[model samples]
Target: MIYSGTYTAIKADVPEFFMRKFIKLERIRANRESIQKKLNKKWLTCGIFTCVAAIAMIGSYRYISGIVKVSSNVNGKELPIYCVQTDEKKVALSFDAAWGNDDTQRILDILKEHNVHVTFFMTGGWVESYPDDVKAIYEAGHDLGNHSQNHKNMSQLSDEEKTQELMSVHEKVKELTGVKMQLFRPPYGDYDNAVVLNARENGYYPIQWDVDSLDWKDYGTDSILNTVLNHKALGNGSIILCHNGAKYTADALDALLDGLKEKGYQVVPISQLIYKENYHMDVTGRQIPDAK
Candidate 1:
């Protein structure tokens, strides 16, 4: 009986020991699975962070390069016809008429006496205030060019506004004089690429000046004469700027014409001086004839 009882106890102890060992092994496996999960999650987070940083770097590079391209384009900006490239001893004298009509007849008489015709860029208000002067200028055999309607800065206008500014004065001049003007000068000498391109699209040649008489300063007759005569930009194909509204432009007109003639420069209108077709403008805004 004693031996049988001892064998039974040993068998019972063996099964209990095996069951405890199996429980311990299961606990270890569970702990190992938890550690592996944590490691996988940490690695995934690091990978995501690295990818985000790389994407940010690429975006910054593109933005900086885009700025560089814009600046480069500005370097080669569009320009108007400041002058012409020609070997002829000819120049153009242009008068901007935005205000006043007191000296209009005097100017016409002086021009007729000199047998010289010049370009007159008139604003819409001027045309309205002095229709007879417009007719007088055209009748006297001069080029009537378009100065923007309201005398606003053309560079600041929208595309449609720019076209309106040009065509408004154009239609007014056309109706008054029965002349479709092909020349346009922006108010305040202000322009951008849109201004120039829109003018061309509307059948106009955008004009600017190389020689400024500074007659608008109302200094005196001698100042106007001295400025135009001694201007450094006075060379072949120079376009001179004057304002008829100035206090002394009419007074200085006769002497200025005589001075220009003495210098052996034939003062012609802008139409005769500029090349209408097959021409290109350089960076200095000089119109150049293309190779034949």
Candidate 2:
């Protein structure tokens, strides 16, 4: 026979001892399920919070350490040596030679007259067209720097292409002058982390200028002189940019050298101005010597 009744009727019919045990067991089960649910919810929330916190910490680290995206394919920051950190009154003058060589001899003569040794960053085409000048620069105690093969924007090239751009010119300069170039300057001043890192991997110190003469603008000789001499960035470890093909650069060279000398600045080639080892670059691209 089956018994059917309301919950209250069933409860009334049950023995008191068994009923008390059933009620206690039901309460314990409910409490256990409720506690388990609360624990699960709390664990889920903590897991999500921990994941979010980890992500935030990584982003903050990247931001504070000057880590940047150079391109879609490359990450992290690698800056070229724009200038050096020093207390000595010294600076480097660098000239990029990508085109015409009409004024190169004249510029060399002026540098010789002043007993100043400067760096000449030359393209492969320029080196090919003016091999004699390349030899002359090497013989005259000037720095021969690689300015790439086709003078393309380094930041736009692939890893292999960038290496070719650097090494092709490197081999050419080496074969022509028997000098292995160790300095590289990107064309049009365009570079990224890849451009700089590739140069370093290939045993070249990537160079950039802090002080720009604006000589490429063809403003005039006086304008070039004034722009360079009065540049606020002109300091003890400044690197000044000029071009061998600029219209007014050769004209302004003598006065620029004289003015720099008058200002108690010793001008030298890039090789002499930079630290060869144990150095690090700051966020602004200034190379600092690691404290011993």
Candidate 3:
């Protein structure tokens, strides 16, 4: 405006040219202001849209996560809980320790370094053999579960034998670490309907893994890693089975944790991963909450 006013004062020297320049500058100024106003309004609209979308996303996540906390039932049958039906990217790592202690301490050290706590289902025999390992596992804040006494298939055992298998290990763990084991993973992952019923009757929650790392097979570390991370069942609330005695597991531990974390999974214990009561299992072995 100041430039325009100065030009206007010198308009008498070149009237037509100065008038034309004045009009052109005024038009340019008006257009710039108009475009800036439109841009400001557009930015305001985008801000509102972003806030609304974020709120909607949070609501959806909560609604999905609420399903796992709610418990459901299926027709009086004692079903083993395999995985939880949740939208959270959380997963549980369960180790069945029924054999050698060669890799136990190494696995524990790796877990400690990563700050990831996993569940260890120890047999009575493993506890008897590696009493200090049991104490160390408990002291390190990992979940202790009953993996039976002799590592025999629960399906082949009578009800009394099953009870003994569970109780013997539970008692030994309690004696060793003062931690009572309530989660049971049947030896060899072998369990029948009766086994499930017996476990529940004995106040233990039978757990099964959806993602099997096949660490028990003693395959290479790469194979175990590929098996788990590539498994189709790898998803939210997935129970992953590993072994404390696997040759490759200790070597694979850091990479396995990194892969799971990179894929946005929070490794938790089975005790924290599963529902204690009021839940039902779907035919696919996924645990769902009872519909309200």
Candidate 4:
């Protein structure tokens, strides 16, 4: 038999009996909601922190990898970035052929007449423009260096872009000359750590000059010669920088060679100048082989 109670009693009993169950159910639901909320908050916080952390890491990597500038000098000078070697009296006469290949034959003729070998940094476009000139440079027993495909600043490019620029020229030169280029000089002497690593990865040594002829400025022959002769430090090994397209450079070439010869300095290709197995990057961004 069902036991009935007074309305007040039923009300009281209803709550008494079900209150604990209801309370327990409500507690469970509230606990679930609280846990869910907590989890949501935790997840949100974690996601935000993760994103912030990722951004910070990316920025730090870019800064350290030289992908972006972390600090600027007070004078706001764009930092020069090439590893330079200055220990040796040996100077490398490296010519950059970008604008005109027409005069390449004349330059080659002059070099041939001197019986002196010079390193030629040829752009892919230049190679394309003058296949015979590229051939002549290789066939003449001079060292060939990859000068990038488009003559763009390789340091400013992404790793992939840098690889493409380097590899394209390397492959093209190899195809044309049947010799893989083992040296690299960035166009305009612009390079950074990325360039250095990219060059190293590609089995090429980075080459930079200790003395610049400043022939690109169309400096007079006397000025160019004086710049090379006066500013050039004679030692066991050194790499001299000059452009092939400059008239003054072409004019200064014979004089510079003669002066170097007079100083008892042997002008040699960069490979022979350093003559070491390992290369190191200097503070000035110049790369030199570790002295054996």
Per-residue accuracy of model 3 over 143-218 as CA lDDT, tens digit each:
9999999989899889999999899888888888888678999887787788998888898988888899998788
Models 1 onward score TM values of 0.74, 0.75, 0.74, 0.67
Clash count, one per candidate: 0, 0, 6, 12
**Of candidates 2 and 1, the better by lDDT:** 2
lDDT head-to-head 2 vs 3, winner: 2
For all candidates in order, the CA lDDT equals 0.89, 0.90, 0.86, 0.73
- Using lDDT as the measure, the top candidate is 2
Report the CA-based lDDT of candidate 1 relative to the real structure: 0.89
Comparing 1 and 4 on TM-score, the stronger one: 1
- Pitting candidate 1 against candidate 3, the one with the higher lDDT is 1
Model 2 lDDT per residue over 142-165, tens place: 999999999999999999999999
TM-score, model 4 to reference = 0.67
| Residue 201 lDDT, candidate 3, scale 0-100 | 82
lDDT of 1 by residue, 1-292 (tens): 3234544555665786775575567668878999999999999999999999999999999776555432212346767789989999999999999998889899999999999999999999899999999999999999999998999999999999999988998999999989999999999999988888889889998899999999898889999999999999899999999988899999999999999999999999999999887666666888877656
Superposed model 1: Cα runs more than 4 Å off: 1-75
Which residue pairs in candidate 3 have backbone atoms (N, alpha carbon, C) closer than 3 angstroms, thus clashing? Answer: 71-278, 71-290, 72-279, 72-280, 72-289, 72-290
- Could you give the candidate ranking by lDDT, starting with the highest? 2, 1, 3, 4
> What C-alpha lDDT, on a 0 to 100 scale, does residue 165 get in candidate 2?
100
lDDT of 1 at 138: 98
Index of the highest-TM-score prediction: 2
Q: How many residue pairs in model 1 have overlapping backbones?
A: 0
